[model samples]
Target: MSFFKSLFSKKQPTARPKLNHPSELQLNDIFTFGDSFALPEAMRKQQLQVVDINTLEFQHQHYAQIVGQGSGQQLVYVSFPNNPKKLIKLSLLLSRNEVEALFDLDAFSEIFEEPGNARLRPLTKQHIYADMIADEYIQEEFMISGYSHQQDYRGTQPPQYTEDQHGREFEYHCLEGGAGERSVDIFIFENGDTDVYLSFLRPANEITELWMKGE
Candidate 1:
């Protein structure tokens, strides 16, 4: 939490200047797209506050925290209630090879054929990382939507997908919300591996209020 606090605390002036070209605006530059803005400090803070392992709740039930570690990598996910129309997806990727191996598994095939079975696998590292990475379609959607590019493709970057130790990196994205809209907030953590969390339906503002009320 402290790490995130520091990461979001570094702020530039809020003033927006006219850009000569969209390319001049770096992905990290806080910019507006439709109803969404790049994850700003306030939004990031709200997300961190509500999504903490200590605060998460869904459907009047507390979430279970599950952790997985192996092959010099680690992954963590907190289980929450599911929405019928939209679901929050979490994935942990240890290596590029592991991701490739996913395509050949029977269980992976079943996930596509029966989507309702997607859930946090048991804490065993092999079981968790292999079964939980974002489904291929979601990965493709993220990439095509430009969110992946904004994060420098950190979620799919091969260097961070290796077994070698490296400093951790974090990336965030916020999609718009409201009536007939399915908003998603994505968080990616990269170390020797990558852990991705996608939040749908429950936007940061609602989550923050829910946490505050102990709901």
Candidate 2:
């Protein structure tokens, strides 16, 4: 073999590790990073441990899916923290930068570990949910896939406009509860009723179809 070929073959690859906790949680990986990086125990004690990591190509960015689980043999909840007395599997799509920021806050455990550890907050203009929805069309999709629902709950993506019977126009949006089984759908006008989520949980082509239909 050539000397340069031998030298290049010995170079190390820079990669992040795959992790699973409890020594029993099994996770599959598309690519493996043999040695895992565990943050200090003091930082992660009550938090969920990384179970698997995958790349998502859906967006025009470095998107990822990081799955984690409780320290014991417990499963996380996908349904609303309380109503469902059992386990559930949920998936979140986030950009790499967002994940890093959340990690810095040690938010994984607080936001995901278990129902008891979750921190709830109200929505305000400062939150990400305040972004304006498309003026072109309105869209909503819901998945009670691994969840149960209350008799009256709905959600909607924002900046959605509506016209009243008397030709008055008003805007509508959802203030909370888009995930799991609970959500609120609110409208500024009198004749509005809400019961679902306005979602971008679909493909670009699919969303384009919605736009065309709305037109």
Candidate 3:
């Protein structure tokens, strides 16, 4: 980690800008990590926030805390209850004012893709403090029909069928829930650094499979 000691320097954190997705704008060299490939930054901003839900009133709330490092540096962790996998961690490189700017609704716009062919989009600096607030929980899913329709694949060997001889073996990774539209895909952004990835549904989006994908 490098430090800027000059009295007048450009290292200062400033007001945030609107947020946007990658392939939606131009960026320097930021990257978003994904399963298939990494993407490039399509937008830029000073901070990011969590809004929509409140910590005091909501059962499923997001909590934030700042931890001090022995080296005199600090890191902030913003965690969500609805999505256990979602957490925004930040470092001392950015000032509290910059962090505050991130929470502003007007700070960010546009999207930035990660470096390779990865399909998931990573979070950006535009994800300021205000974006950290919790407003609501929108339930969503993807629906796909399975081949066997059996509840479990226990005691069964890996189903393999030749496409030419008999038939092709296919599995369904479906979505379930009420009569509303569901989210077919999930984008996971890890670390404060713009790292991103995609989450694929398997065996009807089993919880077991979802956990394994991250590791």
Best-fitting candidate, scored by lDDT: 1
Per-model TM values vs. the true structure: 0.22, 0.21, 0.18
**Candidate 1, residue 68: lDDT:** 21
lDDT of each: 0.29, 0.27, 0.23
Top TM-score hit: 1
Q: Write the per-residue lDDT of candidate 1 for residues 68-178, one digit (tens) a residue.
A: 222233332323334464332232323535434434444323332322232222223243332222223222122111111112221133223234533234343333223
Q: For model 3, what is the error of residue 58's alpha carbon versus the real structure, in angstroms, after optimal superposition?
A: 3.5
Q: Which stretches in model 1 have alpha-carbon errors above 4 Å?
A: 1-73, 77-86, 104-143, 148-215
State the lDDT of candidate 2 residue by residue for 122-175, as single tens digits. 322332322211212212222111111111121221222244211223233322
Model 3 gets an lDDT of 0.23
Give the poorly placed runs of model 3, Cα more than 4 Å off. 1-68, 78-80, 84-215
Question: Which of the two, 1 or 3, has more lDDT?
Answer: 1
